[model samples]
Target: MPTPWRPFASYNLWLQFAPPIGQERWHCDMKRGFTKARSREPLVATLLATDTTPQRIGLLAQRGVYEFHQDPLMLYRSDAVTKVAEILQLNQESAVVQERVISILKNYYSNPILFGKNIIKLSRGDEGFPEPILIEQGNYQFNLFAAIDCIFKEQDGTLHILDFKTGQTDFDRRQAYVYLLAASFLYPTQPAVASFYNLENQKWSDPITATASHLNAFQIEMARISQQHQKDLQRYRHSPSEFKRIFPPNPGINCQYCPFNSICSFSELEVSA
Candidate 1:
């Protein structure tokens, strides 16, 4: 059986490990999706789509009591917000979601102390760093698929790779490390640090530093695991008996959210008594 190719470096791919690999394929192929009357896409897209900086400086006077200059286009951002609402399929839009997104943006933007230059020219935007940096090596191709939310410099000139989250974060460090790894490659000469900002939880993770040797090892591991998954998938597809031998229905933590739970014998779905 010819194995389909998938780059191993992605954080998403590792989340699914079906004893083997073909079980996930079977689950996806057999599962169904339904439409809902109200979708949250509008709120999410609106939050994602607008640039909050312009609004903060131009409209909200978020600089507190300090004499501050506003962005010329602050009022114009509301149009951008509404446009995003249209893109997300919310005809009327939700006031609550809009307020939440704006609040997060204002909070993040106002904290110039945390985001601003303290003692050094570390704010890379202030430090003159490039946007949308790209890095590709071996079978791992990373070209803005997973974006670094923000990249800047610390007072000590440590390059920082930041990821911002709007929801509760319960351990997604692997993704943060991947961002750090990419940043390391992008800035070969500079020391790089990685961290996560959970906006909803109002928490910032302790920044981590990455070594080239460690990043290279992770790259090797990703390639190995990805190729192994493909190989396991081939083995599982050989025959139903062999498939069962390799990819047995053994469900545990992943079962509750598994799309294939309905068809999976080991998922422990309750019988109609």
Candidate 2:
């Protein structure tokens, strides 16, 4: 008996690299949009797998800064460009606080001691950072990309992946699972540990062990979501106007904080009205 040909095997090969000539010609018609769509899938998968400590801390800080605009009680501290310009013109005392915040951010990047072990030195002398690995299992392909904040290797060969968080928030279990999934793919039999160091609170959470079952489930979900997103992109290509109509208007809330709000008619009306 002859071996059967699998359609998915060919499809997976095409997906890993470039499309075939016929598919490429079809893609060329939607090249610009398709490029963005293709880039977004892997980016999302990377985020899922390795958006570890530094990213979480940065995201929390950004959210806190953006919250100043959305909350009325915090509006006086809004750091929006227009408000900053007005404060500068008035020679406000708050400018000093702004400068201090900027200084803190600068020092955070420049001073290694302040961050302590939380800062994973990716570059060692002339040696480069470890390259991210892209792995395919079943229907899903995701990148295992993590810049370890700190790695503790046991004499027995147990590997601990320590992540540092600058925010006061607790460790996100979902994120830890994603890291575990990536680690398992890389080191199938090795024990993996995940930890979070919250700088704001000056605390380190207990390390969490990731099980194989959890990782398998997450991988399945990722594949399904990626496929759905691809389908959504195809539908959007068929009717862009229909896709635009699906989402609701932002109203006025997003205007004051949005960087590009000045050029938007809805924003202009909301701000000036």
Task: State candidate 2's TM-score.
Answer: 0.48
Scanning candidate 1 in windows of ten residues, the lowest lDDT window is 29-38
- What TM-score does model 1 achieve against the real structure? 0.52
TM-score of each: 0.52, 0.48
Per-residue lDDT of model 1, residues 1-273, tens digit only: 953433333444443342233344334211111001111346433443453433322222222201111233433354543433343333333565456554554454444334333322122111222343344556454332344546667777788776555644354666766666666667778887787766444678888766778887766655565565556555545643454445455445545544445445566445321
Q: What is the C-alpha RMSD of each candidate to the true structure, in Å?
A: 11.1, 14.9
- Which whole-number lDDT from 0 to 100 does residue 253 have in model 2? 46
Q: Highest TM-score: which candidate?
A: 1
> Stretches of candidate 2 above 4 Å error?
1-132, 140-148, 154-156, 245-273
Against the reference, the lDDT scores of all candidates come to 0.47, 0.45
Q: In candidate 1, which residue ranges exceed 4 Å CA deviation?
A: 1-7, 17-147, 155-157, 240-254, 262-265, 269-273
Q: Whose lDDT is greatest here?
A: 1
Per-residue C-alpha lDDT of model 2 across residues 1-273, encoded as one tens digit per residue: 953322121122223233333433222212223233333556444533443434433543333333322334433333443343342332342454444434333333333222222322222111223444565667555444444444555556676665556644456555566567667867678887877755344466787875677777766654554454455567776776544332223435434533324333344446545
What 10-residue stretch in candidate 2 is worst by lDDT? 5-14
